[model samples]
Target chain A: MSLEIRNLHARIAANGTEILRGLDLTVEAGKVHAIMGPNGSGKSTLSKVLGGHPDYEVTEGEVLLDGVNILGMEPDVRSRAGLFLAFQYPMEIPGVSNANFLRAALQARLPEGEELEATDYYARLYEKMDMLEMDRKFTARSVNDGFSGGEKKRNEILQMLMLEPRYAILDETDSGLDIDALKIVSHGVNAMRGPERGFLVITHYQRLLDYIVPDVVHVLVGGRIEHTGGKELALELEAKGYDWIKDDIAQAVSA
Target chain B: MNATIEAPIETVSEENDSLMTTGPDFASHPEAFRARQRAAWEKFVSLPMPARTDETWRFADVKSLSIAPYTRAEVVDDGDRAALLKKSIGIVETSGRMVFANDCLLARDIYNDTLRAKGVLWLPMEQAIAEQAELIEKHFMRESGVLGSAKFAALHESQVKAGTFLYVPRGVEIALPVETFHWLSGEGASVFPHTLIIAEENAKVTLVDYFQSAGDDAGFACGVNDIVVGNGARVTYVAVQDWNRKTLAFHLNNTTVARDASALALRLNLGGSRVRDEAVSRLRGPGGRSDMLSVSAAEDDQIFDQRTLQIHEAPNTSSDLLYKNSLNDKARTIFTGLIRVDEGAHKTDAYQKVRNLLLSDEAEANSAPGLEIEADDVRCTHGATSGQVDMEEIFYLQSRGIPLRLAHQLVTFGFLNEVIERLPGEPLQQKLRELLHGKLG
Candidate 1:
């Protein structure tokens, strides 16, 4: 099974400004793909559109998860279909404890009348917290409430690890993370990289690519992938900057 | 005690009044009790109805505050009474339980024999008036209802016949809380349930009052609870009001804090057509503290009006008040609270805050928080805020695969849980949360 986005076109709800234009990509299981793009290049928009954000409208195109059309599904339905989006700015839900919030999410996925055992839930929760270097006290604290930037990112990763979605998208997860936090988060992501899962890592900086090297790196220039290369492309782009790709696209269009 | 018995009583010739209108049967022991009832009844009639322009009653449905049609309900059939007693269960593990319906004691289950031996008096108000006449006469309705429900307070005092009287002696600590349920049945029924609790020196106790309806019958409930915390004593009181949707209710509470004593009182409002609550906490002695909290969920056309006052009379006294409401549909809520520090009550720390979460565009919430500081060195702050549920919070929950309806429910619960979790007792909190969930469901 794979996540397929076919000729996707999307726009912002506020001004009707088109961000994604005829973009197509596929991510098969057991692979990590990174989408590197500069500011205003629709990287975040793509993540949101795939997650069925109501603010972003898909003018035309289809998003299919495991060969089933997902564009018609609600945001929550899309999530229940094994698509998880790690938000660049995770929202703080005050008064909802981390443990309870996670438990609710997991409970939502279960069949009706089936209950999750509290003993096993706590054990797994503690395990994930330890892996992300989060304080055990966070279990009782409100979800992302009063947390630092680094702590919020770690919490996102903790959620991703707990949810274990089929196709997980990390949108700018490395933006606010420090070197130490980056390593910890990348370690958590790396541990989940296997034959049963696929990942789409979206970031603006190449520094994150060094920690969790992707199997393939795609440079999105104007809503679509302008170039596809190996891990070395990330180093080259980091050294020469996105100006080269922009110049190449300009030259090609003019010709 | 002797003075209460020697006071003259009024002779009323109303044949339709089923309640013991002249005086309670036990009023013979304390004649002053009967005289006080007469005086309270006169005061009840003398006080004018709350006006629309009154600051404390602003935005309140003053027109619906009439109590003309409600008459005292008589005891029902034995089968219905037994069914109600069976449904009066509250906390699973309680030291004692007393059930009352239609201002009459239905059943009592005081399990802790040791507490009985330790001079803890857990009995019906009538029984206490006869057996513990001195204690009941001294502490019953001792504090005035200073938060703008004086008329209703007087009405409660005049018709009060059945309730719970819990007296915890010096140095005694009850492990489990005591539960008292007042069930109102029959149409146009009026029940006055009074709870008077006195915790003597260094004693610790908790009393939970549940005001509920047997069915969907329309009724009236005028409840008055007086709590007195003696020197260094600790008392936690919770009142859960779940009347019928067509019922009108008035609950007046007064807490008197003595030297180094601390008192916490919480009121949970779930169901009622129009519910008015007036709570006052008096910090009378040094090192006294009071915590006043309330959580309400109002939906449909229900209206919940709350008024509170915190009076700091001595130095080194503190009080904090927090009230939260989640409104939906065309429901309305009003909160008027004030924190007053007396002239000589220096170093007093008082805080008053009210938060309203509007869940619907049609819902309305009005808040008025005020502070009067006469002390030279005091820290007092009062603020009120009204807003809808945070969009970001909703998105966060929605993004997690939770349906919109369940997400809203969870957010509302979380909003109200901020106040519920602050409660000191766990059992009562759980029970209240369950009731809240049932109402939402």
Candidate 2:
């Protein structure tokens, strides 16, 4: 089982600016695949399109999550179908406590007429919060409202752990975290790795890959995966920036 | 120690069908009160209805203010009384509670003995008029109407006969809140409910007023409540207004704060066809503070018009007002608030803020915030914001698997709960949250 995207073409719905053009990749089950790209390389747009954001229209593409096409599905439907996206800039929901927000997300997964057991839900939530070193008061606080940068990132990871989706897309989860926060956040992500789940960890820095080592790394250029290699490619990219990859794509296109 | 006796209250005679007629029951009251009622009724008749050209009636549906279709509410039958009593549950525990249905007292219970031993006067308005005539005469309806509801306030003064009267003596602090439920039932029924609270020096107390209807019937409700906060005293007053969608209503309020005293007044408007609420807070002594807050949800052709004035008459006094409204499905809301600082009232700090969340394209919200400061060194800030719910917030929730409808509700509740959380007590906040949840659901 895997999440396979074939020749995906997308553009901004408002301005018709193409962001994802002829993109392709596969995240197989039991693997952590890292997609490293430069700025404006459609990393965030890819996550948003995969999550079926209304602002982006998929002109041509078929995103199959375990043989089920999710392009036509709504964002919430995609999430409930075992596809999770950890946003780069998590939103602050004023007045809705984090506990209540997470509970609602979990509650939507239940069948009709079946209720989520509150005791069990809280128990699991507290356990995951403990792993992320979150204070008990955060459960009562509004979702990410007035939170520090590091705290918001931790909250995103905490949610990813609680949801436990089959295929998780973490879009720049390491952007705002400090060293201590990075280690803690990486620990939470590493704990979720197993044989049954797949992860598409999108990051620009090699520092994140050093902690949660990727099984495979792909260099993305011009909205497409230009090259694929072992995890060492992350170190190589860090030593020599994305210029080499962009030049390599230029030469290939000229040929 | 003074003892209060149950006095027999005469219901408004049915034969006197017109609301303008002063029936025999009006004559039965004490001469001083009867004189005041006679004068008020005369004033109510002399004053013309609010017109569209009037400044106070701006942005309001003046046509909906007609009271000709409503008459005095008749006493309810046994079945409706039983049902209303059963539904009067607001908070699980209270120091005391009184239930009234259709202007008739259904039940009352006092749960605290220490407060009574300390000379706390908690009685129905009718009984309080009989037992503490001098106290009731001096403080009842003392403030003149100034927030565009003078005619309606005069009408209420002429017709109101039942409500709650609370007095806390000096240095007394009642830990639990006192509650009163006012339920109106039947078609074309009208009820005039009143609440008067007085807290002496260094006293502390909380009171909640519940205005609800027994069923979905077309009716009219005109209510007036006034509070006097003595020196260094603290008072919290909450009014929960939930009438049937087919009913038109008015709630007029006034508060006077003394030196070093603080007052908080919060109103939640959840139901009504067309409702006009006017609240005026006067800080007459130095170091006084008042917090005026309101949250309303208007949907399905409902109209909620709110007018407020914060008058700072003393130096170093402060008043803060915050109002939030959520409108959906052709609903409309109008908010006009003014902060006035009189001459020589230096160092006065006042703030006013109004926020409206429009959920549908057809919904409308109009806001006007004004400031008139005659004193130098006074600080006053006022603003009003009208906008739709943030779409990014909804996307964030949807990314976590929450459905669109639930996401909208969560955001709306969060917007309104910001004011609810400013309240003092936890139990009271919980109860208000439950009521807000029911409305949102």
User: Where does candidate 2 stray beyond 4 Å?
Assistant: B1-17, B21-24
lDDT of 1 by residue, A137-247 (tens): 898888888999999999999999998899999999998888999999999999999998889999999999899999999999889888899999999889998999999
Enumerate the candidates' DockQ scores in order: 0.66, 0.86
TM-scores of all predicted structures: 0.92, 0.96
Best candidate, TM-score: 2
Flag regions of model 1 displaced more than 4 Å: A112-137, B1-29, B111-114
Candidate 2 structure quality by residue, lDDT tens digits, A1-255: 999999999999999999998999999989999999999999999999999899999999799999999999878889999999988999999878898899989999999889999999999999999999999989988899999999999999999998889999999999988999999999999999998899999999999998999999988777888889999999999999999999888898899
B24-106 in candidate 2: lDDT tens per residue? 24633576786787678767777778987889989999988777677677779898888898999887878888999877789
Highest-scoring model, DockQ: 2
TM-score of chain B of 2: 0.95
Candidate 1 yields a Cα-based lDDT of 0.87
Worst 10 residues of 1 chain B by lDDT: B1-10
Model 2 scores what on Cα lDDT? 0.89
* Best candidate, lDDT: 2
Chain A TM-score for predicted structure 2: 0.99
Q: DockQ for model 2?
A: 0.86
